[model samples]
Target: MANPKRYTDDCALGPFSTKSQKTLSYIFSPTLWTPLLFLLMAAPPSPSSVSAELRTSGEEAVPTEVIGTLGGFMTLPLNISVGTEIEHVAWNGPQKTLALASPAGAVIILDKSYQSRLSISSQSYSLNISKLTPKDEGLYRAQINRKNSNITIEERFVLHIYEQLQKPRVTVKHTMSESTSCNLTLVCSVERAEKSVLYSWTWVDTHSFKSFESSTLTISWMPCDPDVAYTCTAKNPVSQSTSSPIHAQQFCADLRASRGRTVGETVVGTLGESVTLSLTVPVSRDIEKVVWMFNTSIISKDWREPAIAGPLMKSKEPGKDRVWVSDQDYTLKISQLKMEDTGPYNAYLCLNTPRLTSTQHFTLRVYRRLKKPEITWIPGPSDDSICRVTLMCSVEDSGDDVTYRWTFLQKGAVASQEGSLLNVSWRSSEYHPNFTCTAMNPISNSSWQFLSGNICPGPSRSMKHWIILFLITVVLLCFGFSGWCIWKQKRQCSAPAFNSSQVEAPADLSGQDASSSEERQFIHSVLLCTETPTGGTTTATE
Candidate 1:
């Protein structure tokens, strides 16, 4: 409904057609002053005039702040109204003109300093400077002109360039402790810093996952809280950097409190027996809750209500049916204790009067009763007068803590020794010749008696007597055989002489030969008894 010609003319001015210009001149020539007035009103104001007016209105040509890092890129923003027609754009800096763009959109470098370093965005007419240095930090101005109009708009930017922030180094100053709390001081610093840098401290509570921040921090370490970690950050206009985290636990090594104290008790019982782990809370405070733990697992919990007269006990698995806690003193009793139960048992008590907690740690040791020991003698040199023996005392399936003790009774005197093996030299005596060996442990003890006679028995007395009798019989038999041999030799020598005389007698004499033979035999026996005649000088009384 409105005339399009007036709308186009009010927004922008472009090259007019020849017919339009001739028609405008003929109409305006009727009044010579009208042509000049129309020309004057159609032209816009000059750039210098517009700039002066903007300055008089207290308008800022440049941005108030711009951040840039050293050796990095930075952009100066420029804003233009929509549907504005631009004829030329120019960028200027402190010492020289930077760039120029013509109405045809051709950009030309005007300064050698920014020949390759300047860029302009077609969308927003923003100027980008690459590889910025500290020397490039200054105010930059952008100027733009409308087509066929003398009016110009200007924008300015103030760039501040700085080096990237370096990582901060954190150091612990010192640690001091008061009566109930500990105070720690720490310092954070950066090397070769030229710009204004801010230091901030941040810490995280590991237990709660909550975070806190401050310019500086001093910790008041408490006994009940877990470890805390803190980090330091150094930030500048250009960049931000963080240091390595440090923990408060590292500084409070010796200040930590003990959780509980250990009380070692040796409980000795026979196999297949029940043992009670006794615990008594002091009468100074009223017991509100009691808990029993085996190793690290909770085995039993006992609690009493405000109006109840007895405590309600709850037992967990693995020890549910076999464990019992007394209501009076809260002592734990284990039925049929096993070897696997030989570990640490803890009892925790909560009191109501002063609201205090007490923990008692018990190192329970369950042992099996020792069986009767056996005493055996190791063989050694022995004689009739004295005997040396080595006796070994031992028990089957015994623990390493068992000890061996030896007791000997010799010649009305008692001597004892403690070891696994005992060496003894025994002499014949009228007193009981025996010794006792005992194997003992904390749980139980057993002893065995060893008879010295059996331990080192001399050669049997009966055996010695039989050996002597056998030797005497052998000697008698040898002597008798020698006498019989001598007598037989003498008989042989005499009888041969008599036979020789008979052999020298005649070959024939039958009837009257008896007296002759007897006479000859008698004569021969006489000759033999005497001596043989020398050279046959027989007394022949013929």
Candidate 2:
């Protein structure tokens, strides 16, 4: 007691610390405390603990809700490895129960009413259930433990049971129009989940077909005809089900009305241009195949014939409406549009129905257009003098409606007259060869505007002689006028001198002397006339 009073605050093991004391207590009570601590550390975490911890997949523990598929998974923190193995998995209630063990492969299944125990290895731990029943529904719990770590996972799955399934319902998804094609889809679904279902598809016709899927039916093509129907039926071993009359009748009426194929729609196009017609046939019965016939001839006939342009015929099936169908829109384009090309045509298709046909009428009119005429020169006069340049105008295209006019241009004057011929005096020097004639008709007119080639003389030889005669006649008239003027002047000079001498002698003498003198003067004048040469030309001396 006296030695304890000397104790220092710096003692190796202080009295205030509980670490060493707690360690000593654990060592002394190993039998009771060791097992409790091990249990505490190895116990599966509670749902609250798992939920409260915020974690990412790689950084924290794996959640129990997300159990890996059939394969084993490695969780985070590799030091704490955990996995499970089981021989079989079974269900006991509305939800299934699962139990598994680690490494040892020991397995046990417990339902509300049944419990089973088994051992399994990793290779044989997975169990597959093909069909699920109401009794299979139960809670599923799997436990895995390794070393000091353990994991427990729970999954809840509900199983549904069905009584019987109704047949699938189908309806037209697209509207019916002559110019357009429509599509249809059938939906087959049951209100309750069923383990096994048998599905079959059939039409109003005698044909039968089937489907592998649950209870859905579909028809891609539907026509506006009124005699075809589509039907579907579904069944199981315990019970058989069919679609309701309301839903069935709706599709039935739609398909039933689609009896004839459309084959092709009415089409119009320009002359010399072609058009393709599409033909559709709606049939209540199954179609073997489609055969096409143009008019009375087979499709193999030559397309060059006019009959190919005619209406085609389609033979109908035994139970369907007559189908007149054409791949072409009842169209025939003429190589050249002619009045005869216009007519009625038939487009026909060969369907299950007997003979069905459609007709289209085409009216073709051809127009006649005027073409320009060709011209050639006719042979006539050639050359300026001895040969005259004569332009012979004629039309290459002679017709009843044609008319002609002639025109001439010379010496700064323009004169036009109607005829096929024109004549002008030839001038060798300074002459213009601008002659032209035009031919016209009520419909068209053409001029020889560019016909001015070489203005050479044509084939005439009489023009030179006619011009020479005209020159000779003018020269003769000029010489005759000069001779007449000289004769008239000599007679005037001789008469004036004789008249003056007679007047002076008559006043001075008696009547005898006057008479003798007048007689002598008259005698001398007569003698002068007598002595003058008869043929000699005379000149007046004044």
Candidate 3:
């Protein structure tokens, strides 16, 4: 006999016996069948088999939804392997069949609705639809047939087309008065929005950016910063759009409080010095509490009690040890003043009888002390009618805020000038000169002096002395030259000039006295004849 067909739950054929009727009855017994039924009922359904069963049923399978922007391309993915022996492929749309392919691989378009806009990829069997419109949003089915087989694989896709989102608009809903603290509400909305569109709010500050999911945001405190920006964004799965940045200054302009009136004196402090900031409230109001603040930090707070009590002082990290509150007036005293301490300080006094507050603002300025200035003369000295001297005054290790002033003293007359450089002139015997350069800042001042007699002595007198000495030296040289010339003439006269044709012999002093006198006269005559036409010699002498 033919072997009984194997029995399976999925098979629709009649059950076949694996053994004799007696064994089948034993297996079907209550005790055995009950446990089997319980186990079968407890077991989870296989995903693959359930999906296959769903597909095999005539009921339409759920399609995968794809979102796409209008006027854009949409891709419908089909995960199916095209066998080598594929006979034909067909795609069905909501209204009619879209495309069909023959066994010879020639594709034909049955519906000309998307004639040029539809394309198919043979590798992935995915459908590409271009230039999508709102009308294109519908169910699309793809069917693939095997060669000489009745079995066909199918896939369904659901398309959702949407237009690009426009820019959103932000509006302020409510704003309170600027005189008091109040909440501010803002609303963000779009002209047109899809069902899936979501709204988000973003708060942008100088330091950070924060995001919120709600369309409306309420701020408890009035925003004082001009650099902060608020924006709204509308987004969907397919498109996203952002609203224009709204500055806090623009939206919260009416909510800003007026600047507090300045009531205390301006406090000036030197760098690394200690300074006290004081505030006094009017006696008309009952002082219930007092608070002192520096920048954004609280320095002290005093709450009203049954009797007089000291203020509770608090300090932040940087100013902890350096700052404290005094017990007398609740004034704030800061030691070791730093550059960061130069700002506005506030004192708040709360009154109980009238329920009013009085605020005093103090402007604190910290300055560095000026160093001693130095005066130096620039090179290029002049001694024409008046002596012009250029002096540069400067201070070492001085800040940019320091200014220089020059005080010129001439014969007890003082002339003041302000600058880093000074140009002064004086004539001979005109004035005794002295200069003092002062370097000053808001907090301190220092000076340096220069004596003209010490730095630049009497130039005219010195020049005169030099000229006189030069003239004396020239005269001495001329005298020495003249004397030397005269001596040379005398020496020449002592020697006798003889003609080449006549030879002269030496004469004895005792026997030839007359001859010697005659010879001397001849020599003197020769020397006189040898004198130049310039008359350098007045007379000839032996």
Candidate 4:
């Protein structure tokens, strides 16, 4: 049996208080250095100065910090030195004992609540739990000891649980009122407001993009670099997601668009349909990275050059198998699309040969299939041989952004207009017998045909009235034109000419001439329409 004396103890401890004695006691009692060893099992941490200090002092381990995703699995690593044999180990979670290992190298799970989820490794004594929940988050501890030894070695961990981070949005706008300025203000945000999220911005530059450690970034446009692309990443304790790369090549040139959403390609897709975000450019040997990103996640990427293998389809989001990128052209294709798949999608390209970068941005819109359209027509009264009817077109389930168009089915038919209402006008002979109205949206269209004879039968009933109207108008215009010509003829003959000189002529010829010339022609002598002389009832013969 070894003596239980150590310089660390108070009255009960018996030992030489010198440096050698204290060192020997610390070396034997594994509990004294357990904290220092616990840190090694944790996930890698940010760079810190304490690493060197801990190395030199060799006193304590850092508190183990483990982050587990919700509904995921995590293993609390049991970091042990080489050749250290464990007789048995016990695992404890927030509430009570989770599991234990028998000296015979068998795992025995305790806590009935975690019976289905908890498992312990017989050799290393590591604790693993699956399908983690919020209640699983808290402190966890493991105690181990060798056979016939009083010293107990232990490790502690603080477990943090977080759900997947939401997709982030990046809004771009000009900070200045002047439309000419290229200065831009970009803001990055997630759909849900979370406190523990870390945001970083990686933008396209002459070389590989340099990342900024903030949610917002301001930039001064330099004329030399005409095109610039930016991508934002949001990270939680468990996972990280990147935003779609927004190509801002036009943000400076098209100042009018700088104040609203950034300019990018917009694509319309129907729900459950497939769409391919095509990358038209060929892959160059000097290609640095070809990344396909959704709203806040990278669905796929091709990072390897000649040395690297084929494109690694690494997507952590749900329904990841539905997304794929082509090795030949780096085109991204998505199948069985859902609502969450609708967002900004980017195809980012970087080439190291000339130190250049380019990106294509696409905004995907998903819509349900359009419903069937209905056409209703109201016939108006015909006047002066003109037929008029108003046809209103409507869709049953359409809400907004719906457009309407009208087409004439009748050959050589000229009657057609667009809107919710279609105005139809035709002469008695020129009526459009068949017309179709179509209701459409971005994704789908439905058309309804309107047969004029079937819908509006009033054309036959009103046809006689139009024919009579046409005859009456023609008779009145002819009467007016004839009266004007007759009045002008009478005015020219009403003036009489007198000659005072006597003349000699034969008796027979003279009478014939006098009767022919003296009997003046009269157009309407009974009612000399509207002309009255100054003297009353005076008649003169010439």
RMSD of each: 15.7, 24.2, 17.0, 23.4
Query: Each candidate: what lDDT?
Result: 0.63, 0.38, 0.64, 0.63
Q: Name model 1 segments beyond 4 Å from true.
A: 1-64, 81-87, 94-96, 104-111, 122-124, 145-152, 162-168, 178-180, 189-213, 232-244, 254-542
lDDT of 4 at 315: 44
Using lDDT as the measure, name the better of candidate 1 and candidate 3: 3
Model 3: CA > 4 A from native: 1-155, 158-197, 200-264, 281-330, 350-355, 377-383, 396-409, 412-416, 419-421, 429-432, 453-459, 462-542
**Per-model TM-score versus the true fold:** 0.37, 0.23, 0.45, 0.37
Q: How good is model 2 by TM-score?
A: 0.23
Q: Poorest 10 consecutive residues of model 1 by lDDT?
A: 1-10
Candidate 3, residues 1-542: lDDT per residue as tens digits?
11112211221111111222234355457877787678659975455434532443424455567777888998877655334466666787766778876655466877788889988776655678899887888777776555643345555666777778888888875555655334557788877675677889898656677999988877644322123567889987777889988644333333322333334578889988899887785866666566554543444345432111122223354335676655546677878888877766666676678876677778788888877788888634656545666788888767647888877647633333547887776764465588888889888899988887754445355688889999999999999999999999878665555541221342223445455577667645665856779877534321
Model 3 Cα displacement at 542 (Å)? 42
lDDT of 4 by residue, 195-271 (tens): 57899998757776598999998887632243567889998766788888865534543453223343487877777
Model 1: lDDT of residue 42: 96
59 Cα displacement, candidate 2 (Å): 13
lDDT of candidate 2 over 1-542, digit per residue (tens): 00111111221222212432343444337585677678658997555334322121112323222111111221111111133233232222223333333344454543323332222334433333323334443222222222332222222222223444454454335344453233456655445625566665555433544334435554443222222355456665445566543222234324423443333333433333333434344546333233232223222112222221112222234333123233333233333333332223323232344433222222222322224434344434545443243344566645444576655554642333335544433443434546656777544566664233345433344778888887888777666666666676567547746675654454455545335566666645544543456655333221
Write one digit per residue (lDDT tens) for candidate 1, span 46-133. 6645553363232533244577788899887766655567777788875677888764557888888787888887756778899987
Candidate ranking under TM-score, highest first, comes to 3, 1, 4, 2
